[model samples]
Target: MLPTFAADDYIELAADLPATLQAAIERDLGIDPAQYLANAEAARAASDVATALRAQGVDILGTSIDGQDVTYNVADEADAALAEAAGAEVTVGPIELLDSGREVQPAQDHKGGYGYAYQVAEADETGSFPLSRCSVGFSGFDADGNDRYLTAGHCGVDEETGEQFTYPVHHIELSEPIWATEDWANEFPGPELGEFVPGSMHFGEQHDGGLVDITNPDWTGVPQVAGWAGGSGAPDENSVTIRGPIDAVTGAQACKSGATSGWTCGEILVPAQSTPVGAQDVTGFIFNACLLGGDSGGSVVVGNYALGVNSGSTHDGRTECDSWVPATGPDDTTGDFSIGYSLSTGEYNALTLLGSEWELSVAINTPQVTSPEDGGQTGPTPTFTGTVEAARSTHRVEVTVDGEQSYEGTIADDGTFSVAATEALAPGEHTYEVVATYGNHSRSEVASGTFTSTEVQAEALTVESPTNGQTTDNPRPSFTGTGQPGATVTLAVGDEVLGEATVAEDGTWTIAPSADLPVGERFDATVTQAFEGDSQVVTVSDLGITAAPVTITAPEDGSTVAGDVVFSGTAFAGATIGLAIEGVVTESSERVQTAADEWEGELVVGEDGSWTFTPAEELRDGEYTLTATATLDGGDPELTSSEASVSFTVGAEGDDDGGELPDTGSSNVWMIVVGVGLLVAGGVAIAIRARRGGSTA
Candidate 1:
């Protein structure tokens, strides 16, 4: 059972280990034991699900059990159609586990091999005859520093076209092959048979299958081919094979191959069936796997072992396999012939074909770098140069940095280029490609290099977002700067630190505010290190504030009172004033006096306290302050009156009204009540007494 059947197990697997290791490891090993257990459980469930799907004849790419990814070869719709058309039954197998294992080379006994078919220039051609889909395959570099590969003998025959047509086949499962004049078939030996690569081979057939090199290429991963005959087409030469290890090979077991009838696995009736081709008399062993017209030259393997290469099969009447030859046809009722040549024979043939004339060796060497490769340099920009060697120095050469055109110098009389780079490059890592060219022949090599400079100082910075003291409705403003392109820019607001962002090639950046900010109507926008200069601070004024001059019209200066005192100021519209007493503040009050000025409201004075009128509101006062502030709708602010404080006592009134006197408690309440009540009551009493005295006299 796989570990990651359920979503929970899948997440646990990721949490348990690094992402890269997860693919190579099935067992979870980490601090969280539940994660591993959950992965295992999930894998079981997923395996079950995948089994069900395969039973339904659905093809699955990859699945997970416990905590690892799983792969299932469920019969897809196409497979079902093919099976129904052939009237054959199908079934799925158990989940196979896989992980990282030691790398090893393929044994000579492996019954599969690969070779190259070179593309030669056709006679009637202009500039250069293209290979179209054809290219060369290399054997890669062996431990001995020699690189050998294979190509068609005809490809090297033409003097002009051979060198020009030497190009690597992309996405092909083989080593990069360079063109060699020696005949790989005879005079110039080709790659050894049974070699493996993590790519697929195309033989201009209906199917395309890529084989994975488990031992070589360091056990490179292979992209899943839906089934045999579903991947790349197998060649007619029977040169390539996909083999599972011996333990994986099973007799009478169903196997797969890249051929016409993909995924067709027949019971292995006999290990080796000898048969002969008509007129050719080439007798070979026949396997249980049925073969069709396009199944020629395909590798038939069990698990990871290569058993044999498909040769050909007798055609059944009406596109149906004969039942007589169960090993050769879809039906055992009809007569069919399923035959293939053993790899042993192919290997023997290869040894005889790869004579001593063409030396076959492999090695891994660093490709040449055309760009600069130096360390610890400053001031002057560096230039890079190099050359590559081939058995034949007459081939044309093209050098490039990062795949782009850097230098296209040809191989000189000495078979190498001694030229300068086209541009003055900076310090960093660069990928270089060396392409050999001769008429129509071309092969490319890739290498990398790094440059460094310690003398260059970072340039100054400039603000791009908000200008000096620019207020924005958006609390989070994007801080932008102009400096070294692609350089990391550090930003901050007030005392809080903001994160850094890398500038693009163009000097421009955008960032959100760090966190919640103060609610003040105005703030100081301090942009520092914006330029070569030091730092600068600019204060953003209020968005809705103005300033104007105001005069205190009521409550004369230095006036002492125990009751409410009306202190008014003159200023523009929206002007306001507040009373400040001993650092205590009262609510601001406003009253528009004119278009140019406004009169502020009154303030209350208390006993033994200083009093002054401000914008608005009454307040208790040991001392009072008058502050006149004017706000003219989106205009500059004006402080008309400075802070004014005056002290007064409530006892001077001597009202004898007891504690009921309003001025006795908080000055704010007492001022309004006592100040207004005293005047009203005294006036009413005087009127009543005057009427009574007038009547009696």
Candidate 2:
């Protein structure tokens, strides 16, 4: 009966391995023991990733685990986009089979050989003995520290019936070894080492295993797998170590070394199915490897971890096991059909079938980072969290966001951990990495992800007054707006800051320009609100805020009048209203106008911004144009209105205007003489009118 273990045991597997096993681990996997263990934990974590991908509708062909990476194989190249989005490398096609780089396996002879019967002699070179050709899988140790052997159950039991049979284990010492650290193998099997344990042999649809009590300690430790040389009968090459549980996922490679077909390799196939084995029909996973008789019960491994035992292959044991016929479908069982049984499914575990005490050693598993999932979004102050197995309290965490160290500390051993960011993170996509560096009873582990950092937003900023396309005469106009409290708003003319203010507690802001805004023409005003290192800006253009529009607004524009002509119109209440009669009618008209443009007296604009002028003198019959304009009182005289004209004619072209002009066809010299004659009189009349002037408001 295969037993069960806690969830923790399924993730990380750690051990203080024998020095020989350590050496073998580095020799084959080319990595230290700690990394190998951490990688196993990382590989286990990928099951959840596959689940996530499936949830996204991506059909995974297979999966291969190596070191810290898990490569997924998919049929369609388009699936790559979906796989990578979930943070997994994708291979578009079947598994890639790597050459074993070993020697041709030993010759196979069918002995009705459900297994082989190798020759053996005494340890002192005495006599001959009996040995099964069925291959040995992984070695292990019982809780009592006693060495044990693991192999296919069918090797020591009846596949059709359930009856068990005892098989003697053999061993020998080599005088001249071939590429080996220690010189001992079952080549020319020596003496009997041990027999298969009673009740340990069992074969069914789900499980197949038999345990052996290896009394002789000559073999590699429980953490190591045996190796074989090219065309050699003795099992000499012993450098491959058992790191952790094999990745049972498809697209992973299965390698083994057995009594016959010594060292053969194959890659996992897609869509696992069951095949008939004697009376029961149960298979683990499928692969495209070539296997023959005497190879059954051999070790099935992926990477450096122990998987299970070789169950069956389509190639009969009678012929040379050289040709490989890749299976086209699950029903295509004629050739290249091979199968393996996994040690543990979610419900079944054959590794501990013998007893809970008997076990294989493995490396430590890595902790998984669960925070900031790839392509996720979070606030500036994001917290880091993750799931871990074993030694929770001793695991120290160090975190970095976008290459900047964001956190570093220890976590509780509650199978999970959480670390808050010490400082605010910047905006945008930030790649974060988490390292479980210093942990008691555990090796270092690395986890990483990316998330978009977004800032907390306040209300939108707005300007209430000085809106787009507004016209005003007030130079230092008070600007107002509604925005986030404490935000600063500044109005600028070109590059010059006109006014600035901070929004009050009521979310309202007002600004009085430090200097008057430009006048007399349309320009643009930029209003910006800045808060928390970010700013929002808006521009208001074509603001009609210039010199006051002081246009002549009377005399019935284009009207005709006779001698007693009075030119009057609106202007700045405090400014002067002056009329200039020019053109052909100038010489015959009287000077009934204010000398404000000439700066004779200040014409202060009234509070109502309006003023009118009443002339005193009458005009001679002639064609004349009247233009009235206003000038600022206490400012630059050039700041006068460039306003439109209010034109009128005295004895000018009109509908029977004022009878006929006195000088309608007169010579210019005579008209000038007449105007000069009236100049002194007009001056005297203006002086009298100024003295008698009334309020122009």
Candidate 3:
């Protein structure tokens, strides 16, 4: 009989947990301790009901607990009502079980070890090539205590030979050769393996596993699993450590680390399921978590316990239902359902292969730091916190700071511990290392990090006006901010100096640019404050200075014109010239034209940022407007430019002068000559009249 934990025990445990763990349990998992205990009890009751229904010959698919609700999947609606009456939520769906097949070939190349994915390639006598990619299941020892790696059995078998064979297993990182030794296959039975299976399909009878020799000195063997909390494909300093294997349970949240997909999690739908693939029947755990082609043989885990190895995934025709689909496969596929063989079954198979005397286990599960991250900077005094997985074994965790200052603590019931530096040290670079010593005096690998400490007093600095990401047309914008009193504030864009200011007694400072900023330019206003001997810099990025819109004020709208048509507009400094036709084309005979008349012209903006459009020829009798569009190149799209227009009408042919008037449109000189001729004639007529009047007197 197993020991039972009461509700009060859970509440006490929750209350005694560290602040970090409590926050994680509540924020990430969304469940408190009392609620968790109640849900567990409800799940147990639902399981008992399921067992009783099975005894009564009820046709049931499966049962699992989702949150506080105990859910039962059934093939018939009548069975759902029966389950609901028995205090279980019911869902109707097909039993659609699936099995493991050979992993698919890789599409791209990558390199990693342990929980990382790898490719295995082999060529036959006909020069035909067969390739498959799979992840390393776990690192362990065979019955003879020989160091080895485990993976899916189908990864090492050849279809041509229909049997297991030795082949070179390539690691993504190392150039050295790693070989997979054909130790065992689940469906294929060796002469010695028959005794362990006998007639039982639930045990080693349908196991799918293989082993790789890892006695090479170049390879490092650590009891860590990659892709914890959706990590990258490459295993780095943040990989999770495996505590040990645990029994698979339905409705339990499970996650797997694969080479292609990194880490993914879902609930276990069926703990023990017999599924059929192409021509083989595989018995394993079924889950809804995403699995892809290159994810085969990855580790499946629940919390800190290593549970199983990924085999394959199901391909149902409903691709829209799941969050992910295989990178390379058919479309409209709904089934991301995956299957994994339990680690216990793989361990038993290994024992059967090498003899029952050997034991398979993980080595040196170390502690990890959760606060004050590696290569980070902190103040003079710092508190350190981390977690360690020592199972039920007694162990002492020691944290060493700067190789001199040391603090020791014991692992908690939930595998968490914290320690604080006893004294504040002088400002400098500091290092920390955490080590765990077991009851037998065996020490784990050290987890170490380095950080910098400074003694400068902290001060607040903020930009109070024309905030970050603001757009304006003021070229010499004023920047105001608050900083430490008596501090010098220097503002710059990249390496070019904008201006500087000194903080007043009230801790307020302002800076105005010495010269106008370029129109439509975006830049970061890097503000640096220096006080005493310490200085800090803050950057306000994406500040924009927009260009003023072009405005045509020279040619008034709806005015009449006869000749020398001129269009003028004002725009921001350095803006480019742009023109557009704003009206329909009118014949010379037309008396009036609206703004819809066609108008066309182009001109360069003056150095003063003003533009004037002057037609080289005389204007015809018509109405038109020239629309001017000015654009500045440096600002965002929204502040680029604005359109401006002026409309006027060309007077009739004889409205200003007689139809016989000389063509003065050719040149200004011709118009000047015609005006001089009229003046001389008038003067001659006036002289003659005065002479005649003198004769009459």
Candidate 4:
């Protein structure tokens, strides 16, 4: 078992703790103390090397450590050898490092407006009617202590002129009437209305960000970012604070606060990525968090550290917003991906674009949990312990079991606290939450863990092979589990008996169903153990049986043909046929109704399980891969029979005689015309002779 800590706590403790203290902390937390210390040291050493390389102008993406080995995530694989020679292990990342050009679009309608995080502003074109809504990135001051704020460069640019500056920005915070038009010259100093000016914009080939000058004295900027209190909880007073920028690594949890989605947390998919958006290229990190239109310029943070700025989502294909849409049914498959520009790059660009006069920084760091690990499993009476960085402050830690407060406690002087559940937990998996609050109601992000409570006196039953929720192509799955020694075990599906086995001397049992289970049916596998007059039952839910395999026969692979081509295949009877010709799916006819069970359309499958397909139109002269897929009715649509594909080529066109047609031109036409003329002259003479003879008679 490994000790668990909050992500931020792990990073801090790993980098700053003494070796002896690290070991003692790990041991107390039920983790490998020695290995943890070694890994920490190695990680710190690797970070130093990375920092040096970065200072020397190397484009290192990020770095992570596992045990005593460090893996450097770099864009270029050629740098692997050089990084390894620098005294630590290294690996190349799959991300490409490219620049993203200017991003622009028309403004959108919003429900309401606010000052802090979700404040909305519009950028209007100089002589046109185009405008766009954008959010404020963060607040910072120039070297001269002048107030300024940051936003996306695309937000300030005029789409028609392709220019950044000269565009008028309008906001309601300091402006009177809040919804005034962009007639800046006449609207200036008019009562309660005011217009903000654009100072500088950078649509660098590598980044799409900019800084806007907030000249109004009535408007103020805060050092804190907008987010949920704990990374995953609801928005509150103790949401998040801005610390300095921190290097982002893969597998770390990151959150995004935007005007659209508010705050959502997801793991960092790629620490460094360079991808193309339309004509422009963007270089940054890819996260699994959801982003939407008008979310640009939002902050991407990890705990107290500002990591990146929201750029755009990959789901947007330039036509419409492709934000995450939840799956509607069991077969509905949809996904959305988001991208952000690293704060490290953003900071550099900020200084270069706005001149080295501006200084950027964040507010205070929220308290963090450092023990009992999130999402860990333990006994029913598991001990809950954690620590906060705030010293000499009264800390109250609330422990909630399945969303209800069960226990509360106070922290000790050493920044540590523990609590034991007073009530007994039932035999099953239960979720527990630990929320630590310190100093004037300031609360740390909530920490959560899950634990399963098993009765000591009851026989421990655990499903071993063909684990719970396992999907298999084989209808008859092998089931194995451990139970009380000499106990009789019977496995069943609903009311149907599968098989039975007796626990051996070692307390293990195995069984297999005598008959194949129906495909696509979700059923629970109940394991019953009877001892004396008592019985125990454990179930594995959602075991899936997949479709059978299939094969294509005629129009053999690697053969050339033309005209009407025939495609045949063999599949199980009553199975649905999916045919694709040159990557385009063809409509399928109903299941064969005849005794032989033959199905027909562009493709035909016989009841004997043999199938054939003939294209309705003449086959084009080109190489193609004809694919046939079989699907069973009750199973998942994604889980179907093995696809059968045949590659064949269509040759040149043919004639009526099955060969090239003979050429006939002007000569044949002239001969037919002359023969008709001669026949007509002879027929006229014969008619004249016959008329004369009849007059003489």
lDDT tens digits, residues 446-485, model 4? 6777766554354676778776778888889888989887
- Model 2: lowest-lDDT 10 consecutive positions: 105-114
CA lDDT of each prediction against the hidden true structure: 0.34, 0.54, 0.54, 0.51
Q: Which residue ranges in model 1 land beyond 4 Å of their true spot?
A: 1-443, 446-459, 464-475, 484-697
> lDDT by residue for model 2 over 425-455, one digit each (tens)?
7889889877664322223456767889889
Give the alpha carbon lDDT tens digit for every residue of 1-697 in model 3.
1123355656753454333333333543356644444444444445455655656555566665555355556778877777666655667974334333433221111111232222234457895554454676665554555545555555555434545544444444311111222111221211110011111112134565556555445564455666323333234424555555554546665666665555665556666676553334456677766665556667776655566777767533222223443222112134356777766432233234432332334544577988668887665666678887543234568888988888887776456777766666578888999987643334678999987776757477777867888888888889898998877898887778889998998989999988776557677888898764457888887888777788887677767766576667788776765654322223334233222111222344677678776544455444455666667665465676788767776665224322211122323210111111111211110000000001110
Total backbone clashes of candidate 2, pairs 3 or more residues apart or in separate chains: 18
**TM-scores of all predicted structures:** 0.24, 0.38, 0.36, 0.37
Candidate 1 minimal-lDDT segment of 10 residues: 684-693
Evaluated with TM-score, which candidate comes out highest?
2
Worst 10-residue stretch by lDDT in candidate 4? Answer: 684-693
Model 2's alpha-carbon lDDT is 0.54
Which digits, one per residue and each the tens of the lDDT, describe model 1 over residues 307-355?
Answer: 3445445544212233424433223334344544333221221112332
When sorted by TM-score, best at the front, the candidate numbers are 2, 4, 3, 1
- Root-mean-square deviation of candidate 2: 21.5
